[model samples]
Target: MPHIYAKYISKVLELPLKRDNFIVYDRFVNERAELFFVSQDGVDFALTLRRKNNRYLIKYDKATRPASTFILTKALSNLAIALECEVENSNLALVQKKESEVSPWLLKPNFFEKNPTFLDGKQAELEVGFGSGRHLSAIAQEFKEKIFFGIEIYKPAALQLLGRIERENMPNIFVVDFDARLFLQTLPSDSLDKIHIHFPVPWNDSPHRRVFVKKFIDEAFRVLKPNGTLELRSDDEVYFKDACGLILEYKTSNFHVFKNRQILVSSKYEDRWKKQGKDIYDLIITAVKKQNDDKIECNFDFENAMDISIAEQICSLPAIVFDGIVVRFEDAFKSESGAFIIKIILGSVDMPESKYIYTRDGISSFYPTKPLPIRDNMIAFKKLKEKLYGKSN
Candidate 1:
């Protein structure tokens, strides 16, 4: 025997009852209806109602199971109904919440052109992740002739800067909603006059694998003109040193280093970080393309020839390697200053390919050192001899 519970039957069911009440009237009962009830003493009973001619006939019967079965079934059925109602209500609320939360920075291009007086043909420059737009706004004002493009992903910050741009009627500035690295790939090569990336997210977990690694630098170098400048600013000293090392490895002639603490155009985040007493570092580097016939000369000894080969391969992969050492026929030659200076030319294999002599040191203190000529074909022979009978005897 099981416990019994009372049940009610309604003609029309309002699935979710109103806030305060949970009862139905007798008049609401309809034909061919059944109501089941169970008692706490483990008795089960059911009442069936049907229309005969004009009046309704009510028949009662006992359940084959027990009163406990009726009570458990009734509780489970009610729980199912409540859970369904809750799920539906929650889904509706979530949809409404999402609908109401629209970004304020969403705007059309025509919105920017509403006041067309600000459009000028200035040198176009772009800065990614312009947090508060303080540095961008300052640069826009300072270089009125240059069009400044800024991209930011943060909605509130973007909205704030959009309001400022509209209020000031700064026509030379354009804002894009995107990441800086992705936005850079879309621009035409050599189209930009300058690009400034100040205090960007330094993905510092791996020093060798920064956002501004060899690939990023190579892309920046490609997009820039023959002498366009790429400025990088950061507060991390370790990151700055790693960046300097990468730049040296790339071996560009037009490079300049700067101090972030000394620079006045500090970002809002930078200011906050400064308040925390973190020393900031900045490096400004420019990339210049080599001329068609420009020669790169360096000094190299046979002992360190492999290192020189790796460096050359890294700097310019398509370059041809030459073998031999440079020897001066005479100790000193006449100079334009009426002084006797050392005259030296590299003597190596006279192949048909264009050649550059590389040496480790210079003839005197002031003269530039030359690169030793070591042909690529001779590398295998050198390796074989070393393997057979140690280093060169």
Candidate 2:
């Protein structure tokens, strides 16, 4: 997980008084530190307060970057005021540093919500593994009407593109940092016009980790519009041939192959490889059918809260698989009043939905982050509900 830098302040025996501005969680807390979350206008930021070297300081807890620095800055300001303490290095420099580090639009919480409109029903294009974003950046700028979704799990590459998007102010482009294979399942069928995977990791030694798995190809086929093309450009012959073979595994699929094809907007890696006189390969698979979206029914209400001690024991135990769905409690924390929260994973083994379940005031439910409306999660939710509440009933 990435972290934000902060200067030291006075050491305190315990955390400062809780305020409405901060949303704190103790699941990840140990003897040394506590974690708190803050959200501004639906954009979330994290604060890690800890004591080190006889002094106290705060660090921003972020996996990638915060969507809104302004909110974080304001939250910090409010904290300083509410706590009645003076921060030594408090100035515009700190705020500027946070804002300049990443763009606000990079990690908007409701980004997927806007996908439905998708440039007012214009065609949607997706570029998976958009490293350096050389191709994705140019294409998004060129096609203003089309909504472009660039998926890149690489932190630096995604942030670089985020800066470019902020500079160019391209409204049609949305960048997401997640595995392309899992993210595809969240989309509706026939939602994309074109899909591009350029210069992905070969993962030759760990072939199973490669992106062109059978399930991924099947997902691509399901999400793409009829005649929509899934383009893959690669320099690794192993990956190229493997991807081709995976697509061909489906007897109904048709594709076009190219050798040493030209790249319109070359990435840094591509430029370096091309200078060395390396051969490039391109494979384009066109979908022939418009499949229906997978039915998802993963929501349940829990009104009975379990005991804090029991919840903690459950979280520390191994995962349980019910109805082919794997559900595990990752962490447990008890509040001052004995209210407890458990961070959990619910869904298929490959892509489990990570969220929290809060048992407070004699009730429990999925919380902090809602489980995605998917069938695997629904099944997991049913099993979990039964596991926790069945005995009481």
Candidate 3:
């Protein structure tokens, strides 16, 4: 945990921190703090800004996943600048550092589509929400003939796992920082041998945020090979019951329920739960038949990109849609460096496409990285131009 002691100025400044890409959510769940999503270096983290005793403090405590001090430093720096607070006590300033080495084993969403087809004569296993990656690392070490893909939405936890993987030199383990449901949709039908969800976020109050929903269960079945098992171990009885209920709704017979089942590997939370005398429950779903992949045809390459000025004007429009496709202009930010950033949603309303559109020196493109060349995203991209310039290629 990193802390900064400074007398925060209640009066705000019109700082040039707009490029920091700060998007504030009223609040997430029952927390009194405001959830601030900060984007830096193409990666984003949720920072909580809470007011306590008339003192404003920034915290990086969004989910159960952990955040590093190095990351907190960046978040704090941005908050300090935006709030115009001078740091009186900061440990980050105590250490001067050079550019650190970037981890190689971790993959990004931009590289998902072009990922090489591994033909190493080994079955593939995927673990979603590999918090701290203890279970993932152990499974990878034990199963040398099997390829392991660990999907995590938290970048810092993923980065920490990448360093550990580098030190251990595990050859079969691959880390992907992305939404598991979306990533699972990209896999070939009947390709994976196993899918693991250990102590996943219960999201008890918010059922929609759960990973064990109908769509995810369907995707799991689609991506799992015949007789492949999708295992979920959770201590939350509500989550466990909900998961089993979802599987029952799918009308699958090859499912099993185990109570306090002993496994070769355990996560940090699992160990803690065991020590605390908390009973663990397991819901396993085995795929009995191969499922067909959903078809979506798209050509993402646009013949002609729109002009920046016209694109900016178009981005200012209200929600526009065509045949179930929708686009909404969220916000536009201008940096002191003379760059424009627009946050918008494109595609179907249920799962609209999202990416930062950038304009600088009259050139327009997606920032952080381009969207995965998926069919819906391509349609969304076309809608962006069509809505803005009144025509699209």
Candidate 4:
């Protein structure tokens, strides 16, 4: 999250302010702090202003931040300038980034409204969690005939890759800022020629966060064409062994495990690991059979206004767990207006979405429209809605 620290001025700030293609729509204040909802272009996020001893600490509301940071960074810079306050110290310097500077290769999650047919008839391949974009760029340059898709949740890495794509003029490569697990589920069945998972996070403390899980493997196989491969390269021996065992036990046993095998392209991290005498492992699983694409169907919209009593009760519950769904109400904030800003963590246990639900004048809605349309998330959405507004026949 980009933020800035400025001198605190004992003066009232006006609302509905506009500066540099950004508008501060509403201001919400409570005993704790104040929230200014700012919109840049069509994207929106909140700037939290907290008064310290003699300075104001301004930072982004993590729950409401958009996936890409390009627009948000520029908007924050403009807001800082509009305040006209003396800056103290900040990571987000007052630098404006032009919209034209944004790379066309970058994509938001909404780009996949349904099963994406953007690939047309071209041979499509994907690399999960492209950290440095080196391997992805190398392969895309080598395979000029195939369309390459790279998924990375890290904002900085995604932006860096976007810069590389533009600098190198790789029109065939596309970068998506999203969870690879959910992204795979949104692709048409048997559409991808190959899926690459190179040096994914080990998640030793929490194995559930790893990319080589059973559900993810199932989705990978589903999206891969017949005889197409799902390749996994890692430097973590434990992760490699566990992933191999899981794949062998849960899915088809048609997979191979290699040690220190070199590929066509290598990432810098891989080079460092090899220099340190680290053994690199590779697991290549070939899809044995084709599977049908299952459309994810669910909506986060409420049929009626939210009941205040139900909302209040939800604010008190530690957590609501049903089957594979878990909903936890984290915090509650009251606005100057008669509105409730409730922060919650709900959805699939593996990849729960943390978001804010805004409620005012009886109407309630998710700040960012909706959560990812994964099956577990859909289940959790239904259960949460039922608990909030009661079951609808």
Candidate 5:
């Protein structure tokens, strides 16, 4: 039912909606404008429009803060109106903005079979949700040889990262314009060496619980090598703690927790959080693939006894007891007679009478009702047992 708005950007803004073949939308507090398109979902979005100088730019609001997806859509609509009027008719000189330089490898897959490389001579690292390419670019600069792949669904962020890659001339980095979770799922097991998730959108509401949870960690673990590191940083305390708990429960390794050293990376969100004096928590968890010995085996014998005892207790009640109660517990024979022989016995009688009326360790049929509709009483008894215990088959 819930869909991301960025996916439908091209179809929403037709020719009739575009003025001067350009549309503008706000990205935070930026007055920058870009060619725009509205998606089929009626969400106004900006695209990279190429000018004479081969420079691309997007226009949007400069002061809007990053909120939910709905807030983003509203800001785009506001930017589109301003872009239409500013570039209405005048043919102005195309001045190239330094940020307009696009990366050749942006939105393309960088890792390949022929050019296999290792991170620190051991593993490869992958990152998701590279916002402004600041942290990613820094990491690319530090670890030049590691296979670093990034995925961003938002066009403006993707374009910004592309420009940053070209500007920095970082060859080790590759970016994709798709959902990173889906991309990670396609990778073979033990393919990645490490994974870095820096401040992903924390879906705090209950309905959005599916967005950020153990599933992502499970996928990360599945793709990482036998013993790989998963480093995650977040200013949201609740999210950080929740993630830590999940890692402890699911990941089989020793976890190390630390406080972020107030390092101002390229992320605007992180910068804002730092300025607001928010405490950032960093959880670095090293997970190893659990061996067969680590698995816990459960005993079902106690559970089976508990089920029968519960049923017997319920059938002993006055409302449930009509004439008497019959309980059948079965165990299969290993001999030529392969059928299971169930011990059926009647309850609520004297010792000798109870033993005489019921079979000791075999199938015993008895009427628990006085009326001709004997099937109804049997159905009721079965239903009562099922509700109290569980399904037998």
Candidate 6:
């Protein structure tokens, strides 16, 4: 959300040039704003500079932002420097200094790079939503041979745990800033030794957003090795019961429930909960047998450029929903270079992916890349393709 206010912006600026830490690759313009495809620290996204209250406000295009705000802030500051425009009420000064320390254990979501194998078939354990480094760090130190993957959606918590990993020199621990529900889908069947969900958000009001949905539990069971366990620890009894209900929906019911059970490590919240006399709940599901590695085969390829009128028509309709998947064309931007960038949100109802697609002369592909090759995503992709460019040949 870092932004700067400038008095004026040049209308005739071009791209494909290096500017400090940012590389301006392309520019797009519409009545609403002017957007530039920029890259910094190997992260590609769009930056927008638009008129507001007789002044210009520049910021990241929300649909294409990277996971780390620090990186975005740095890029924005460097961009301001490149623009050579005076700004007001900006953190541009703070990020102008030397770059902050980055951890070696942090990872971006690169699941689709030639079908790269995460952990390379090694015996691994996963901790979803590792708020602090306490549980994951402790387990990693205890089991040096087994790799530990920690998934967190919050940037600050992930950064903090990454710092702890670096400080403690725990090379076995890797942290990813992503949604655990989607991340689980990327893992291979029977690849993980254990999966842990500790202190997950209850999401009572938004049950669809809960991590223990039927599909997530199905994925967890799929990824667990034979005799492997998927454990859930929570201070909220409602969430615990909800998870139990969902797990029972599966074919196998090799699971157990515990109350006020002790673990290897206790988080500060757990300690406080115990002091307040709250009954902690635990649900452990055991993988009774190995699951088949049913890999989903699909691709996001466009053979022809879509007509402008068709694109506009599709964008005007409500979201297309089918078989637990939803595809929606959110917005469309026509670049100055006669290209179109269509912003889209599509995937499973519980875990959707948002990205931009660049369409121009002899060019039609996802902006950064395609969505993760999960079953739900694949279904959504095919459905979206049919809607846009007709049934595949």
Query: Could you say which candidate leads in lDDT?
Result: 6
List TM-scores for all candidates, in order: 0.44, 0.79, 0.67, 0.86, 0.45, 0.92
Q: Give lDDT per model, in order.
A: 0.47, 0.68, 0.68, 0.78, 0.47, 0.80
- Put down candidate 5 lDDT per residue, 1-393, tens digits, no spaces: 011122112233333343343333211111222323233233333332223333323333121112123334333434434444233221122222323233446542223322334332544677778887778788778878676777777867876777677777887777776556545544556778878788877776652433346656766777778778787888988888888777668535667888865444547778888889888888877756634322222111112322323333443454433344343331211111211211123222111011111111233222111111122223333533464456622
TM-score between model 3 and native: 0.67
Clashes of 1: 28
Scored against the true structure, residue 162 in model 4 reaches a CA lDDT of: 81
Cα lDDT for residue 30, candidate 6: 64
Which whole-number lDDT from 0 to 100 does residue 151 have in model 2?
A: 88
Evaluated against the true structure, the overall lDDT of model 5 is 0.47
Please give the TM-score that candidate 1 achieves against the real structure.
0.44
Please give the distance, in angstroms, between residue 63's alpha carbon in candidate 5 and its true position after superposition. 33
Residues 128-232 of candidate 6 have per-residue lDDT tens digits of 998876889898999999999999877778878877776778899888888888788877777899999899989989987778777677788788888899999
Q: Ten residues in a row with the worst lDDT in model 6?
A: 95-104
Candidate 3 error regions (>4 Å): 1-100, 119-121, 251-253, 288-291, 307-312, 320-326, 331-342, 347-354, 358-364, 375-379, 382-393
| lDDT of the structure predicted as candidate 6 | 0.80
Taking every candidate in turn, the Cα RMSD to the unseen true structure, in Å, is 32.0, 4.6, 8.0, 3.1, 24.2, 2.3
List, residue by residue over 253-300, the lDDT tens digit for candidate 4: 688888988789999999999899999999999876644555657877
Candidate 5, poorest ten consecutive residues by summed lDDT? 350-359
For candidate 2, write residues 94-172 as lDDT tens digits. Answer: 4554443445446433344445554345699999888888888888888887888888877667777777888888877
Candidate order, TM-score descending: 6, 4, 2, 3, 5, 1
Q: How would you encode candidate 1's per-residue C-alpha lDDT over 322-368 as one tens digit per residue?
A: 34322222222222222222222323222111122222233222122
**Highest TM-score, which number?**
6
Give the Cα error of residue 103 in candidate 3, in Å: 1.8
- Measured with C-alpha atoms, the lDDT of residue 2 in candidate 2 is 23
Which stretches in model 4 have alpha-carbon errors above 4 Å? 7-15, 67-70, 77-89, 94-101, 154-156, 204-206, 275-278, 288-296
Q: Which stretches of candidate 6 lie over 4 Å from their true place?
A: 96-102, 112-115, 118-121, 288-294
